[model samples]
Target: MSTQPRTAVVIGGGITGLATAALLAREGLEVTVLEKQPETGGRAGSWETGGFRFDTGPSWYLMPEVFDHFFRLLGTSAAEQLQLVKLDPGYRVLFEGQTGPVDIAATREENIALFDSLEPGAGQRLEEYLESSEEVYAMAKKRFLYSTFASFLPLLRPDVLRRGPRLARLLLEPLSSFVAKRFTDPRIRQILGYPAVFLGSSPFTTPSMYHLMSRLDLADGVLYPMGGFHRIVSVIGDLAQAEGARVITGAEVTSIRTEVSGRKTRATGVQYRSPDGTLESLDADLVVSAADLHHTETELLPLELQTYPEKYWQRRVPGPGGLLLHLGVQGTLPQLQHHTLLFTEDWKANFEKIFGKDTSVPDPASLYVCRPSATDPDAAPEGHENLFVLVPVPSDPSLGAGGIDGAGDPRIEKMADAVIAQISSWAGIPDLAERIIIRRTVGPQDFVTDLNSWRGTLLGPAHILKQSAFFRGSNASRKVDGLLYAGGSTLPGIGLPMCLISAELILKRLRGDTGTEALPEPAPWSATADSRPESAGRAAGGDAKPLPAEPSSGDGA
Candidate 1:
């Protein structure tokens, strides 16, 4: 390895890409970020409509310390750079057919009290659950999340081994089972399972270990930036640029070029198609892909250098794609909190229909509503609200299986109206549909077409027993020498914090500090057919066997 300032090319300027580039640059490497959109912040992008601003994607800001750690690495605090306000009642939950709503207060004690009010001894049970979750979080941070694990030894350390039984217990139990075992009240179970939905998996399939998400909220507290999540993208973008990284917006990368033959094959640079239709190639020594892993492997890399077979993707389950409604409303929503979940009575059936049966909207489906104006006045005009509503839908093409037919079809409108009606009745807001100043919707097709997500999957591969941990896409590309993967689709699974950790893991591999042997080439591509078997393919070659089930553990904070 040379000590020279290595040239790095970051594909896709999302949070993961930007964070990776900034971290690498701060380490004295030369970095450049390329984005296809007119601006940065891939899914977290912002837009303006009818004189109002909407965050567009990723409205919730959980785990503020993750952001703080990112900034702290650069000798600054995130709060010092961005104005963050801790939400009092983190968010609200409106259960279907329930009389009153549930609020998650900031402090752990307060949140426990709220649960206690629902059941006789729920407060004590919640505390016990949280303590176990904290242990999971601590172990996950040290063993699995922070560093690269090319082999299983890192996860099999003596300390982790001692905790293995507990972890296995947590993993074997489904989230629904765990929640039910803990609390007698259905409302508490609903609260515990809320974050699992965001992972694109249902509580029935998602492991109970994910309950750490609830502890995270009650312990760390929910927060919001003064402006919006976009402000976060802007600040990180600024920090990356300050570290001498060049961010080129509106530049779409068409392909990645690699040298062949010799053992030390390396990434030369990339071929990009600009907005004006001009094709250009730039040279680089290293490449980190933060875009969709499927697109990067199948499209950007030449077929002669492809990695795993298309069949590998077939066995994996992709989570449901969401149908989003972005609205700039005209009057205040009196009872609406900063965040709310309107749970459908038949939660399990709805999930089964979407994930198992590959169907569309259910008659009474779970809905997540976010009224940013409730927390930050700047998100909307005086007495107005900026509401982002999301409902889970099937990612498959067989439309009308459940209720909706397709995007922009009458079925979509009908479903949206039904959700609006529910909100209207629950909040006692009259003519809620009429107050809309601007409306924008994104469905499964949009996720596939625009974001290039495989099978229109919202997050990445499902967090199933066979797909989690090292089973997920490896951070360092096995096919190409110099190429690395960093995003929601890779190791450590989905979520803002996990994605950031993914980037960090890739960086550690690049620096050769994780004790793994280096690839013979810089960035090697795999040459395999789409129908090839999972075992013994060209690009990042390895047996495609399912990874053994380890323990239930937390992720890096």
Candidate 2:
């Protein structure tokens, strides 16, 4: 080992980036994080308005194990640093034209009992399905999630190959198909498939293996920090600082520096514009980019230094985007739950409009509304409520065509009115529009500007077979030797847990931990394979393929 310590410069201070920096610093490496935003958390950032605290992105905290493991790796637990409360009824769903809402409680028995009430025999089916899902989750944690796939041999292990048939079955069936097969009720299917929407894909196309989300949801339970998700970043930032990592926010990286040698074009550092608009250069031994894959690959690095061609992006399926609304109600909402999904009558047709035809809005729209104040009273002032509403919209190129202009867009106002009206009707809360004390809206255009997301996709790429695993943006960049990737867009796909796992996998790869315990290998499925040509450019325009019928969905509630 060299006498000098390893120095790493992390680009982006999002959850994955901060996790990576903190982990690296704990490993005895000198680390520095550069964040373009004024603060950390990236999409999971938080803000305060009129004394109400709201997590701007990622309201639900799922997969507490991921966070626990991360903190444990640094010789601590989140409980010691921050107060975490597990939600009882994880979330509630209000189906279109339904009289009562569906509550997803924390306890497995309660969840089963609730399901049993909806559909006779559903409780037993749910138990069986969860058991299977638990197995898959266990396998994923050991094999696919933790290991780096630089070589094929590790995945080809005997035990993993033995379970290839089961994995293959999961890859071939969609979450909808899987849930339908397991439970006879449409309501159960809807409940099981609800999480997929969070993944930026529909249950009709997402894989069945993603149903493991339900198992993870009930088994691990959903959690929230006292101050919201941003507290996660603050705690991690504190830990990083304690570990001697320098964090510099409001530093916009302009370009990456690399050596001339063709074989060893390692990242030297980055040239960035400071918060004051002054240009400065910082040097490092390695660079980790936690920004969106498109921005990091297409814009930040020099063209000649790029690894994959333009054709790669063309063949890959990018994730979806939407309009986000943060509202502060003047009075308390009696019936509102911590989390709620208001569905439209035509779910399939709505998806087709967004993903298939690339339309601007769904005819009958479905939305996710989160009111954290319901569970945590401190989230809002006494007798007041805080709400975060999200409507899935097409992340098409035309999102900025006069539909979103300085928060005064007529379309946005119309959509917000529609949402509030629907909520009022469902909960019997009269004059919801009149109860609004404060409001903030972020449309698809805002996602593009603030997060640098391609086509304003909230998540990175669609978790289709062709865009997952080894096929996704390589963890280690093809062009830059010392650069690696972690977060939603990279391997392991979208969501907080997956992104955290991505960070761990990339760090292990960077530290040359390739020979550690091998993970289980997924069975060969044509849909899961990477078929795009190397060096695919972003300029090539093509529609994404329909999502695969595999077993994967979005993150937890």
Candidate 3:
């Protein structure tokens, strides 16, 4: 055995890649991260023009504890890395036919009252609903979310065995049906069910297991980092470098180098296109691709060594791709909150258009609008407001990308025009379209071109019954011994917080930690660092203890 630190190569410099690099470096592994873009952040890309800054992806910060846990393992805290401001009215929602928009108040009591107002005697029902959601959230964090599901035998453990039937029921029920069971009001049902979209799923198809999402914003509160999600990228980048990880941007990983011995295959390293456009290969003890799982498994590795082949993806349903509109409005808008959701009257039809058999863009699009400038002045100029809008569309890449001003694919521009006018009439911002000074649009096609998203799905595989929790893709390669994966596409499912959990899972897999021991605290020493963040990132918290056997998934990976 050699005494040298093990070398690891991480592909993609997105949140997952940066986080995995930082943690692995702190664990004393010599890690190198490769990114194709000029900067990190992958799909959570950023843009700056005319003094306006926009986070091109992932606007909502729903799960605070996940952020807290991720940072704590790395010897920092979310409070210390980024200035977190809790939004008072977490968000405002405009229902098409309703006279007044409703705010998801900062406090649960207020939210309960708001729900009660919409539907008689619904306040107590909201309480019961959130309680159940919180319970499921707790169960998932402890068992499912952080698990690799390395084996299905864990399902036989006493605790899990007892909860198996409950868990199954939760997974089997659609989130929309689950919400409808508790709330009679359409507004209330929509409010509880919309979190499914954050997972790149429709409320109608996503499992009720995801209802925990409502607990985060409704009870725990929504948070915004001062500089948008880009700050998260910055924090991870700095930490990775600080912890001695070599991060290279403008380096596109083209293939995974593998070795076959007898019946086993193991990844040796990766070949990439460097900044100078030279083809280069780097050898390593192990490889982790934080890029899209489909692209990583199908395109990067040989057919024989693949954990997930292209044909395998044919059976999986994908989450919705989106038309992202980043607008720099010239004047302040008093009507909009820091976060707002404009839902069309025909809610079912709107979702049916996006996720139904037709798979078409909705005419009167139900969209999400984030005005970070309401909370952060620096997001816009003195009298201006910056808007980050998301319109769920089909995952087909042929819809095409968008350009500056009104210069975009005719179809995209047409939809953009319709949504802008829809918000004007619905949200009561009459001058909304005219006031735009700077504009950029990112479509499903952009997701493919920029992030290598498969089928142009923005959030990867949808969290439907057969595609969520342990049923999602595994984190390790089946055919390749030393290859691993980390990102929204893999198990535990989508969202920024899930990306952080995916990183921790990578560290756990590398350590061969099958037991449910929580990650250790910082050792208050300089042995493993040339800088700060001197702790091994691990499970959130709790004393070392044995966990139930875990359920496993197969994706080749």
Off by over 4 Å in 3: 1-5, 516-518, 523-557
Candidate 3 C-alpha error for residue 372, in Å: 0.4
lDDT of each: 0.72, 0.73, 0.82
Rank order (by TM-score, best first): 3, 2, 1
Better of 1 and 3 by lDDT: 3
Candidate 3 residue lDDT tens string, 1-557 = 11233778899888899899888887877788888877778777678878888888888887887888888777777887889999998999999889999999988889889889999989999999889888888877776788778765544667777888988898888998999988889899899989888888899898898888888988988889887787787788777776667777778899999887677677789999988999999998878899999999889988977778988899998899889888999888879899999888798888888888777888888899999999999888889999988899888898988777878898888888887888789888898988999888777877887888999987899888888877787899888878889999996779899999899988888776654433565644343445543333221111211111110100011
Better of 1 and 2 by lDDT: 2
lDDT of 2 by residue, 271-324 (tens): 888889999998987888888877888888877877654566776666677777
lDDT of 1 by residue, 1-557 (tens): 23333777889888788888777776666777877766677677676555556676677777676667667665456767788888888888888888888888989999888888999899999999899878777766667666567667656578878978878888888999988988878888888887887676889988887787776787778888888877777777766776667777667889998987466555778999776879988777788889888888888986656665566677778877777777888988868888888887887888888788656667677888888888777677786788888887777533321221133645566667787887888766778988977666666665665667788766777786566766675777666778887888777778777776776766677666663221122221233434433211122221221211110110000
Model 2: runs farther than 4 Å from truth?
Answer: 1-5, 401-406, 515-557
Cα RMSD to the true fold for all candidates: 10.8, 10.5, 6.8
